[model samples]
Target: MRGNHVIAEAAIRAGCRFYFGYPITPQNEIPEYMSERLSKIEGGVFIQAESEIASIHMVIGASMAGGRVMTSSSGPGISLKQEGISFLSALELPAVIVNMSRGGPGLGNIAPSQSDYFQATRGGGHGDYRTIVLAPNSCQEAGDLTYKSFDLADKYRIPVLILGDGMLGQMMEPVELPPEIPVKRLPPKEWTITGAKGRPSRFIRSLILDPFEEEEHNWKLMRKYEKISKEELLWETFSIEDAKMIVVAFGTAARIAKGAIKRVREEGLKVGLFRPISLWPFPTKILKEISRKVKHLFVFEMNMGQMVEDVKLAVDGGAEIHFYGRPGGIIPTPLEISRIISSYYYQKKLG
Candidate 1:
């Protein structure tokens, strides 16, 4: 299955009933698949909105009505939806957002890129809130993460981001599709804006007019985020035990780094790979533990050193960190990365 289509299909099986998005490269297949597939589902709905901004707001509406909702786009389109994302955060609504990012600053090409790392992890919109960020490197992880994202969003009442790049979005891979979940089996959302007819009067709004009330609301959101950072963390490690050097990466870059590590291992070098599946709530504590054992850490990314910052914070001076990056949409091969890894390992005399 193509990665983008897998996200759409996985979402359907996960009980996502509403999808809102505009056409954008790399991820256009998500909406295209959703539009055709959703039309046939029992309660499914798909809308190709007039703009990305409009689509995100539409997501807010569906989520407000207690539906499993999603929206997808590449870098530029995602940028246009930032304000609504902040709105979703303030409203404390549950929704899934897919970013099959492409090269960018403005109107960057449709080719694969990971330049949105900072944007996705840092709560791109205007707010002091954060959305859970999940980075999936392959089609399988992409599908699996999308299926899981809905649950995470509802569990925390926060938006969940499935971060990917054009390569993952466009490639084909054999993925074991998730089983279709019955929508009726899903739990009810008590906060939905259903009619207040029979019960006591109630309303939902993000406008916390008074400054003191807003401050409390902000702290409440921070408390929720703290809870997430504590409980919701995911990462993968390969050949990490007894390693002299570790390479930290996520998403597609991690896959490449893994291959490079394998190659270096065959040459009798003790190099390992660390992949952070949850970009936010980053693998700080565990990574710090690894740094105590391994004195050298390296970070690789398609973009110019965005995730490296997190790696540094995790190591916190316990390990010496090195970085190699290919910015501006240049995809490096495993051989190229392996050479760099070998060179760095020997230079540090860790052989």
Candidate 2:
């Protein structure tokens, strides 16, 4: 399955019947697929809004009405949707926002890049809130994690981000797809503004006029975020036992690093791989635990050192950190990274 198509189909299986989004590079297939498939499902709604901003606000509206909704875009488009994403967080709405991220700062390129790490993990929107960010490396993970995003969003009543690069979004792979969930069997959202028949009327609002009330709301958000950080952390490790060095990466970069690690290990290298699945609730505790046994950690990214900062903070000077990056949409070859790893291993005398 094509990566973007997989995500769209997975969203459908996860009971995401409402989708509002605009077409954007590298990720246009996501919305395109939604536009086609959603209309076939009973009660499904798909809207190609006038713009990215308009699409995200539409998502907010659908989510407020207690529907499983999603919106997708690339970097530039996502930038336009940030204010709406902030509003979703403020309103405690459940929606999935997909960013098949491409090169950026400002419409950099359609080529594969992980430069949006900062934007995705650091709560790209303006506010005192955070969204759950999931990074999927392959078409299978791209589908699997996207299916799970909706549940996480509704469970926590927060926005969930699916962060994928152009490579992951365009790659073709065979995937074990999940079973489609019947829409009626989906989880109930009691807080939504559904018709208030015979019940006290309730309204949804993000605006808290009182400073004290707003502060309390922000704190409330923080506490929920803290709970997610503890319970929702996800990561993957490769052949880490008795390893002297570990390479830290995520998504497409991590897939490349995994290949590089395998190549080097064939020649008796002690390097392993650590791939974070959830970017926001980073696997800090586990990474820090690995830092105790491993002293050298190599960080590789498609961008100019975004996730590396998270690694540095995770280990906190307890280990030696080396970073390699390819900015401006350049995807490095596995052999090139393997050679770099070998050189660093010998130079640092890590065996």
Candidate 3:
């Protein structure tokens, strides 16, 4: 199945009963699959919202109604949903969002790109908040990550992002869907709005007018973020024990980098790969640990360079830092990456 369809199907198995999203390229398959399949479920609801804004708002509503809800889109459409994302953040709602990003500053090509790195890692909307951003490098991870995203969302009571590029969404590959994850595994969402029946009326709010109350709320959020950082930072490392250089990448770029690292190793270069599975609450500590053993670090990405900044901060001058990237939807090939690494190693020797 296509990766996009895998995400939709995986969401079904994860007990997501509501899907609200608008149509967008490279991700149309997700909503299409949902529209076709969700209705068959006993309580499933699928809505093809009129706009991205409407779709996100619909998700917020569904979430309040105590349903596992999700929405998907590309860069521009994601921008339209930022306000709602902020609302979800402010209310501390548990919902999942998938950004199958295409190249873009504004309505860019449908080709694969990771230009939304900042938007996903940083709070894209107004106010102080963060979303747990998960990046999947393969079709299998796309399904697995999408399935797990809902649990992370509920765990944190915050929006979680499955950050994939156009390549992952459009590509096809084999995947083994997990048996349905029983909802009993997660703690009950006692805060969700079911109704005002036989109990006190419930309120779902993001606005705190008082200065002291708002300040306290922000601190509470910060404390939760700290816990997530400590507990949820996830990444994968390859051949780091004897590596002289560490290549850092994520998502599709990481997939390509793995091949590049393998080829470079065959040429007798001591290089390894560090792929961050969680972008926000990034695997900084792991990078630091690996940096202690390597003399240099390189970051490869589909954007001009965004994750490189985080790599630098983690390395903290312990290693020489370099970046290679192709912006505007161009993917760097394995050979191209190997050649660059070769040149970099030789240049260091000469210096």
Task: Kindly report which residue stretches of model 3 are placed more than 4 angstroms away from their true locations once superposed.
Answer: 182-187
Error of 1 at 287 (Å): 0.7
Cα error, candidate 3, residue 113 (Å): 0.2
TM-score result, candidate 1: 0.99
Model 2, stretches more than 4 Å misplaced? none
The per-residue C-alpha lDDT of model 2 at residue 267 equals: 95
Q: How far is candidate 3 from the true structure (C-alpha RMSD, Å)?
A: 1.5
Give the distance in Å from residue 85's predicted Cα in candidate 3 to where it truly belongs: 0.8
What local distance difference test score does each model get?
0.93, 0.93, 0.90
lDDT of 2 at 216: 97
Supply candidate 1's per-residue lDDT for 270: 96
Against the hidden true structure, what lDDT does model 2 obtain?
0.93
Native-to-model Cα distance after best TM-score fit, residue 153 in candidate 3, in Å? 0.8
List, residue by residue over 208-294, the lDDT tens digit for candidate 1.
Answer: 889999999999999999999999999999999878999998998999999899899999999999999999888799999999899
For residues 54-170, could you state the per-residue lDDT of candidate 2 as single tens digits? 999999999999999999999999899999999999999999999988887787999999999999888778878899999999999998999999999999999999999899989
Error of 1 at 288 (Å): 0.9
